[model samples]
Target: MNPIDTDPPPPTACFTYGSLMCEDIMAAVCGAHAAYRPATLQGHRRHAVVGVAYPGMVPNADHRVQGVLYLELPDSAWPRLDAFEGEEYERRIVTVETDGGAHAQAWTYVFRPRFAHRLAPADWDFDHFLRVGKARFMADYVGFDTLQPR
Candidate 1:
């Protein structure tokens, strides 16, 4: 008889669109660099969250959001990322397209339905974030430690 093969599923890939797309943020969160590639998530619109600098994605058949696809993250890393995201967003499986015409499945954060009131009507601009908001976000952000269940 063939040997039984039993193992938990491997760690997952993550797709990041806003502040988490910054190497500085991910490195700080996970305590190391995570590999990533440029990819686009279709059929969703990313909007600015009310009273905050971060962005949130909502389903829109005609829209698309471009971001980095971080590959094969250790399951150990998800908690910190989750804490950093807080309850405002939920991780969901999404299909992304790379420039080479390849498609992939990765986990991306989406705005929680209960938190829908936080989304702004206008689309979020990553350029504006890189130009102005990114610095403030880096300086003032508290780590996931504070957010861990107490």
Candidate 2:
């Protein structure tokens, strides 16, 4: 008889650079907590979205974005995450390098091409966000209460 194969499929991974990098916000939106690590994505830039507390990422060959890589999120999380990202972003797969220098593929929300004009000229600062923006973002972002899974 042939040997039985019984390995579970790997979970989907995500790379987040903005407010979603905060575990509190991520759990509140996705309804699950995930293990995460520091990572960097090449050929991209993270910029402050004008008049908002969060940032939006776009492709920029000259830049690299530092973020967090979340692992093993339950399948149920994607729809809520998608709803939270709204029409302004489109989720796509990209490769990221972990702090340990290992490369992995993960999904990331990228700002849509039409909204590229909304990005500020300066890069978004994650430390600044933790210091001044997290509270405001958690309280005011309308998407939290209205996530309709598609």
Candidate 3:
């Protein structure tokens, strides 16, 4: 009997904002067949702050955060992703606008301000996040510590 047989598959719609935005991480976290779509959430911004379990931190605000929306993933993978994120972040229903101008309601993680703070950078460094910080930061979602340096 193989342990692989006991574990289920991954989820279909797993959104990636940080390191997971990179194709390689996505493939590793989810699976080969997972497809990612460029999507945006209106009135929400991504910030780097308050270091915790994951890497840095991700907190939402009135500003918008640009990210890639993953397709629905297998249910089996949800637990791993959820555990990686932890309790500070809560899964919520959100509307994501795709490049095609279609709005779809999906689940996303949000950090509580009472436990954390807002990200102060004028804009989030998506490229930098994709390259070095995403994977480390996204392992856990915490409130913002401060803004990214200019």
Q: For each candidate, what is the lDDT?
A: 0.82, 0.90, 0.59
Clashes of each: 0, 0, 19
Which candidate achieves the best lDDT against the true structure? 2
Clashes of 3: 19
Cα lDDT tens digits, model 1, 6-32, are 654534788899988887777777555
Q: Candidate 2 has what TM-score?
A: 0.89
- The CA-based lDDT of model 1 is what? 0.82
Runs of candidate 1 with Cα error greater than 4 angstroms are: 1-11, 144-150
In candidate 3 the C-alpha lDDT for residue 124 amounts to 50
lDDT of 3: 0.59
TM-score versus the correct structure, for each prediction: 0.87, 0.89, 0.66
lDDT of 2 by residue, 1-150 (tens): 334666534439999999999888888788889999999999999999999989999999999999999998899899999989989999998999999999988999999999989999989998999999887887797468457786
Worst 10 residues of 2 by lDDT: 1-10
Order by TM-score, highest first: 2, 1, 3
Q: Is candidate 2 or candidate 3 better by lDDT?
A: 2
Model 3, 86: alpha-carbon shift in Å?
Answer: 1.5
- How far in Å is the alpha carbon of 31 misplaced in model 2? 0.5
